[model samples]
Target: MARMISAPVLSQEKRERYDAFRQERTFNAYSVGNDTVMTRIRHKSLDCSPGCAVEATLQLIDGKWKGVILYHLLQGTLRFNAIRKRLPNITQRMLTTQLRELERDGFVLRTVYPEVPPKVEYSLTTRGQTLEPVIMALKAWGDEHTTFGHVPEICADMKGSPTNS
Candidate 1:
């Protein structure tokens, strides 16, 4: 059964604890600087909070661009510019940073093809694909309740788009 995890917005303490958990995982990730770390420590579970995994989920996906990124990826594999077109307000830097984070967190697979300039595209990894149902549910909730009907276009004009005209 899916673990029913309803965590609050990440508090500073939780973030600190999560960092500690990450450090612990890193330290415990290897055994005394050996090349076969996982071979030795393969069976042990890292020390984590009661709901650390769930907490990590909220932290990774609840940010401004994350949900949107995941949502568009649900539609299909999308190039960086396609994502930018969907979210005209996000700066190129911000989008780049978010994609990097998602890749780091194993939720996004960024494929860079060798081409004229560069051909880069992003899609949801299996782990990320698992999140579609949950994200869609959240989207449905927002669509039904948000005063603006939760349309991206409705919010698009809030700042009149981010690019310099």
Candidate 2:
């Protein structure tokens, strides 16, 4: 049988207990003789209200560029410069940093090719691909509300129709 660990509730007693447990749990994970210590053990927790899935989701894809990068990757894999071209406003440094972060978070994969100049490509990993529906939903919402774009023909056709009314 498997045991399930439920999320702890955020309350005064819980916070105090957590704090006490954290303090009690701290120790020198590594030590050199009696004078020096290399590392200390610690347990970190996100002290947030209950049911904070939105916060968790935002932590994974909150930045201005991550979602955009993910959106572009949804089409297929692209080289570094190709992604950069899609988001012209992003600096090379920023793009590189965002890609690295995404790759670190298991949402993007970086593949390097053995070539003269060392070609590099970025694509969504399987975990990243799970975000497709989210990206699509966001795109659909943006398409409906953004001022710079017009409604799709299908939407336009239905706007004033009897069923819509």
lDDT per residue (tens digit) for residues 100-156 in model 1: 999999999999999989999999999999999989998999878886544554455
User: Which 10 consecutive residues of model 1 have the lowest summed lDDT?
Assistant: 34-43
Candidate 2: give the clashing pairs: none
List the candidate 1 regions with Cα displacement exceeding 4 Å: 1-53, 149-165
RMSD in angstroms between candidate 1 and the native structure over all alpha carbons: 14.6
Instruction: State the number of backbone clashes in model 1.
Output: 0
Please list the C-alpha lDDT of all candidates, in the order they appear: 0.75, 0.78
TM-score of each prediction:
0.60, 0.61
Query: For residues 23-48, what per-residue lDDT tens digits would candidate 2 score against the true structure?
Result: 44234232333212222223244445
Best by TM-score: 2
